[model samples]
Structure formats: structure tokens, C-alpha cells
Target: MQLSPDEHIFWQYGFVKLNATIVFTWALMLVLAVGSKIITGKLATGLKRSRWQNLMEIVVVAMENQIAEVGLREPRRFLGFIGTLFLFVAIASLCTIIPGFKPPTGSLSTTVALALCVFVVVPLFGIEDQGLIGYFKSYLEPTVIMLPFNIIGEISRTLALSVRLFGNMMSGEMIIGILLTITPYIFPIVMTLLGLLTGMVQAYIFSVLATVYIAAAMGDQGLKQEPEAQQ
Candidate 1:
């Protein structure tokens, strides 16, 4: 049901709004991710097997494989970034299951913050991979003359990444929401299945791109080597 304009404003700007929900939900996801790791590790150590242990193992193994393939052989290095990103995004996407809840990714702020987090981590990883001096020099790539343009390109890409994800996921939600409003029964079911696919794909895209960003920040500039011009 479309809310009255006044109700919409209140829903958006009231004390408990999307911003608060996003922060709280992400904090909850962080806590759960950490708690799950600790509890499962202890349980696995104490007992031969447990249901939660097996389930969590599957999740960790899948995430490990993802990191191994996209983040190179050193999956341990990606524990914090991939773990946090995947957990937060996974939880955020699932929030739509509650009628009153909205997916945080539906807001530009959430997606922008996520992109900024990846952008910031990239530099930190780069500096870790290459010392500060070496990292700064990497902006020059094949030549120092390219440094300014490279820097600009990097900044623009972070913003573009944010916008791309924000636009796709948010628009998808809006379209589905509209369809549900228009037709009560059949349309919503189809929309729900479609959304399920979209949600998973968006999460995968986010995770893969985050790994790519990390690789770049870790001074794997070779990953972006330009091909020679065709003869």
C-alpha cells in the first residue's frame, strides 16, 4: 500500500529510520559472524561434530573457495574483508523477509559506505603489500606521467562501483515492490523468485568485486596490465 506523503516523510526521517536500521543491522551481523566463528570453533574442538558446526563449515568452505579463486591462494588474508562483507550483505539481503524491514542495500548510503569501506581497505592492503613509498609509486604504473590520471581513475571507479550497485539493487526492489502493489497474488510470487536470483547475484558481484579491489590495493597492478595494441 502506498503510504501518504506525510507518512512517507515520517517513515524516512523519523528517529528510527533507514540509517539507524542499517547501522544496527550491520552491527548485529558483525556480532553474529564473530560469535558464530567462536562458538563453532569451540564446539568443533570439543565434540566430533554438531549440526551448527557442519552448516557453518559448509559456509566457511564455500567462502574459502571463493577467496582462493578470486583472491588468489592466500585465503587467510581475506578472512576479515570477505567474511564481514559477505555476512553483512547476506543478512541485509535477507532482511526483506520481514514485512516491516527494508534491505539496507536499497539505500544509496549503505552501498556507498560499503564501497568506501572497500576503497579504504584497498589502500591499507596496498601499503601492507608494498611499503608506503612503494605503494605511492605504484600509481605511476608503467610511467610517472600516468600517475595523475591513474589516481583520478581509481577514485572515479570507487564512486562508480558504489553507484552501480546502489542503482541496480535499489531499482530492482522498487520494481518488485511496484509489481506486488499492482497485483496481489501471482505477480508477487514470480517477483519473489526473481528477487531471490537478483539478491544472490548482487551479493556475489559485490564479493567478487571487493576481492578484485583488494587485489589491486595489494599492489597486484599486474592484474590490470594493458594489452599491446593490435598490429
Candidate 2:
């Protein structure tokens, strides 16, 4: 059995090739884009609303509430970024039920890209909230000797994010594949349901961790300002 969606190549031109990961990822993005636009186009501000609109608003509000609970003061400011991350991962896993369809997240490249997005956004948001100097100054907190360690921690966490997602997704796919081979009927169906639950849980976890990181950045800035205010 193929270990990853990367193994399914659709096209090749010398050194360049298109694989299932790239194709499925783009397909997923397109669906999300078009679906969102369609759903939002007729958004009603009045008492009467479509069921789809209500459902969409519920999901969005729940996500925003979760972000606020995580310590982000203005959740809307971070909602777009964090919401997209959760939806992408959650949808990728949910779509696996389709026959012959594979989730791009089963590939290391996809997970790494997702993780790197988080890595980059962490500092960007921090800088936006704290100003460049103030954000960088966070590395010197408690002592300047912590600089290298802080830097290392950032890099290590990004790597961890990527590997954690990739391992969980790939292992799930592998387990399902093995079950299908050994007992082609009942067990695989049960496993598929469990996989869906696991996928959603993982999505929640990844999103929450990302929110924590962003909140920590802003929290550090708040802490730095507190002493000055007190003085």
C-alpha cells in the first residue's frame, strides 16, 4: 500500500511533476474558496436567515469564542488565520470518506507547509501587536542568555508541529490500509469512523496550540508593559 498521497503522480514534465498531494490540496482550496463565497454572498443581517448561513455563523462564532477563551483579547483579528487552519485540517480529514480520494495532509510536505505558516504568522502577529523592537525584545526576557535557547525553541516547535501532524495523519492512513488488506469489510468501516473522529480531534489540537503560541506572544508584550505602567 502507498504510504502517502505523494505516491500518486498525475502528470510529469521532466523534473517537474504533479502528485496527488498537490492536486488534492488545490482541489480542496478551490472547494473551500467557492463554497465560502457562495455561502457568504447571500448573508442576511436581518432576523430571517438561511439554514446554511446560520450553520456557517455558528461555526464561525464558536471558533471565535474558542480563540477568545485562549487569551486572545481580540479574537476577530486572528480569526481568519486560525479559522482557516482548523477548517483546512478538519475538512481534509473529513473528505477521506470519499472513495479513491486521499488527503494531502497525509504528505509531509503539506504538514510542513501548514506548520511553517504558523511559524511565520506567530512572529508577524507578534510584531504587529508589539512593534518590531518590542517583539524581538521578548527573547531577552528574564535574561539575555536565553536568546539562543528561545530561538531554538521557536525552530523546534515548528518542526514539532509539522512532524506531529504528519505522523498522526500518516499513521492513521497506514492503519486503515492494513485493516482493509487483512479484513476487507467490517473492521475498515469502523476504523474509518474512528479516523474521522481522530482527524477532528487533531485539528482542534493543532489550532489550539497555534492559538496558544499567538496568545503567548501578545501576553509577553503585556507583561513587558505592566512594570512600566506600574512605575
Candidate 3:
């Protein structure tokens, strides 16, 4: 189907106008995942260098560096989760340039859903890394009495993640909409670029925090390397 100019540009490039581009984002994500996987294998086999390879290389390296810096002992295991997140948010946020496309992430629902996934996975992976007892103990951190406050803080992190992302994206969208209404000419260009940059940075911020949470739950609660750091 031909995307209405707004939908078309939004789907391909992450531009927004009216409605959120869930369908387009999902379809784009499916295609990118399939294509990236197929192309990654091909690249490993010495396929000719091309734009696609370069793009994928950039993504892979960035993800790897993030995982390493977060101090995840099994950085490779977090690769798929972190990479999928960064890519999804990155694409959804950037696709705002198309005339009609809205960013899915500007809505609290989308950000909450992503945060929920991190909430689920951290505990699951924490158990795998530290066992149930260890996971619980890790939460106690520096003192047993401080556990209650720590638990409350942990729960709030997910809330902060969702709210921060939704607020930033939505605020940007609202400001642009208002400006476009008053003076639709050169102003929107600046807003669009700012939106694009905001989207990219927010995506990185969200995923990196998720990584750190998982790393902590795995017993690196102090964010310091210890001999018995959980892998």
C-alpha cells in the first residue's frame, strides 16, 4: 500500500504528523530484524562492503560498547535485548519527519510497555546470574535495614524510565505543533531536527539504564567490579 505522504515518510524515516505509527514501526522492525540477521551472517562470510554493512557494524559496535561499559560480565547475552530496544526506540522516534506519522514513543503507553519488559527481564536474568537468594540479597545492598528504601527506589526506577521518555517526546511534539500552527515555515525544520536528536538520546538513555539495572540485579549492585561479581 502506498503510504500517504505523511505515513510513507514517517514509516520509512520516523517522521510524525497526526497518529502514532505503530503498524509502520512494527513492519519496519520486522523487516530490519530479518534483514539485519541475514546480512550479519553474510557479512561474517566476507560479503562485499556496502552501506548496509556499515550501518549494521555501527549498531553492533555501539551496543557492545554499552554492554561492556555497564559492566555486564556476560555482555553477549544482553546483546539481543539491548540492541532490539535501542533500534525500536531509535526508529520510532526518528520517523517523525513524515508529514502524517506520529511517534509511537510520545505516548506513555509505549514507553511504559518497554519499561515493563525491562522490569520483567531484569529479575529473570538476575535469578539466572545470582540465583533467587542472591538476587534478593543483592537488593539489600550495603545494609539489611536499608532494604525497604532500596526496594522502593528500585520500583520507582521503572516509573522514572517510562515517564522521562514519554514526557520528553510528547513535550517536543507539543512544542512543534504549537510552533507549526503559529508559523509553519522555517520553524518546523529546527523543531524536527531537535525532535530527531531528542529521540536518539532518549533511546540511548533508556536502554543504558536498563542495562545498569540488570547488572545491579545480577549482584553488581555497587556498580563496582568485585572478584565475585555476578556474570
Number of clashing residue pairs in every model?
0, 0, 12
Off by over 4 Å in 2: 219-231
> Each model's C-alpha lDDT?
0.68, 0.86, 0.76
Question: All candidates' TM-scores?
Answer: 0.79, 0.92, 0.81
lDDT of 2: 0.86
Model 1 alpha-carbon drift over 4 Å, by segment: 1-20, 23-42, 220-231
How many angstroms is residue 126 displaced in model 3 relative to the true structure, after the best TM-score fit? 1.3
* Model 2: how far residue 204 lies from native, Å: 0.7
lDDT of 3 at 110: 72
- True-structure RMSD for candidate 2: 4.1
User: In candidate 2, what are the lDDT values of residues 77-180, reduced to their tens digit?
Assistant: 89999999999999999998988879888899899999999999999988888999988998897699999999999999889888888888888888989998
- On the 0 to 100 scale, the lDDT of residue 77 in model 3 is 85
Pairs clashing within candidate 1: none
Top lDDT: which candidate number?
A: 2
**Deviation in Å, model 1, residue 71 alpha carbon:** 4.2
lDDT of 1 by residue, 30-130 (tens): 76868787766667565578777877778878887877666444677776787678767766666555565566666677778888988888788778777
